[model samples]
Target: MRHSFYCFALFSLLGAAALLGQDKTPPAKLVLKAKTGNVTYDHAAHAKREKNACPVCHPKLFTQDAKAPVAFKPPHKKHEDAKASCGSCHRAGGTAFETKGNCTNSKCHVKATERKG
Candidate 1:
C-alpha cells in the first residue's frame, strides 16, 4: 500500500508539471477599428520580433485580453510624448518607425478592399 501511494503521488506531480509547462497561446491577429481605417495588429509577428518574450508588452504596454481597447487614439502626439500604448515604441526616435508619414502606406491602418465572390 505504501509503494502504491508513492507511485500515485509521483505521477500526479509529473502530470501537473506537464500541464504547467505549456505556454498560453496568443491571438494571431487583432483588428482595431478606427474612423480612418482599421488596424490589423500582427500579434505573431510582434511576438517573433520580441523572441516570444511576453512580459515585454503584457500587462504593461498592453493587456493580455484581446477584447480590451488599445487606448491609442488620435492627436497621437499625447500618447507619443508620454510613451504610452503603441507610442511606447512607435514614437519619434523610438524603437519602431514613427506614425507620422507612415499612417496609410504602412501595415498599421489598412483600408479594406471589397471582396468579389
Candidate 2:
C-alpha cells in the first residue's frame, strides 16, 4: 500500500510538470491543399510576419480546429474577395506574397512534388 501511494504521488507530479511545460501556441505548422499543389503554412513564420498577433487569424480567419476542411476552388477569382479567405492576404502588398508567385519558394509554400522528390 505504501509503494502504491508513492507511485501515485510521483505520477501526479510528473503529469503536472508535463502540462506546465507545454506551449500556449496552437501549433507551428499546418498543411493546406490547393488544386495546384499542397503547401505547408509555417505558423511560426507567419506569427513573426504578423508580429505575434493571434487575432489576425483566430476565430475570424480560422476556427480552433486545425484540421478543418478548406476547399481551395479554382477560377481563383471566385475566392479573392471571400471573408477571411487566404487570398485576402496572399495577394500583392497585403501581408504575404501572391499564391501564384512561385511554387518553389520555401518562404510560403512547397509543392508536393518537391516535398516528395
Candidate 3:
C-alpha cells in the first residue's frame, strides 16, 4: 500500500509540473485578418520584447485565447487614449511605434498580390 501511495504522489507531482509548463508556452504567432490585409502578430517576438512576462498583456490588455476577438477596432484614438489593446503600446509616445503613418508599405497591413497560374 505504501509503495502504491508513493507512485501515485510522484505521478501527481509530475502531472502538475507538466500543466504548469504548458501555460508558459505562448503561441509563436497569431494572424489577424483585416479589411486592408492580414496582420501577422509575432507572439514570440512580443513575448521576448516583454522578457517573456505573460502578465504584461494577459487577462487585461488581451486574453490567453487566440480565438477571441482582439477588440482593436477602428476609431483607434479611443482605444489609444484609453491605453487599450495594441494601442496600449503602439500609440504616439508609447513604447512602440504609432499607427499614424505606418498603415501600409511593410507596416502593419500589407495587401498580398494573387499569383496567376
C-alpha lDDT of all candidate models, in order: 0.90, 0.69, 0.88
Is candidate 1 or 3 superior in lDDT? 1
Q: How close is every model to the real structure, measured as TM-score?
A: 0.76, 0.59, 0.80
lDDT of 3 by residue, 1-117 (tens): 999999999999999999987765567999899998888899999999999888999988998998889988887788889999999998999999888888786768878899999
Candidate 3 segments exceeding 4 Å error: 1-24
TM-score of 1: 0.76
For candidate 1, write residues 1-117 as lDDT tens digits. Answer: 999999999999999999999767788998999888899999998899999999999889998988999989998899999999999889899989998887899557878889999
Score residue 102 of candidate 1 by CA lDDT: 78
Candidate 2 local lDDT, 20-94, one digit each (tens): 997766778898876555678777887788898888877676776778865445644555556336766865555
Whole-model lDDT, model 1: 0.90
TM-score of candidate 2 on Cα atoms, chains taken together: 0.59
Clashing pairs in 2: none
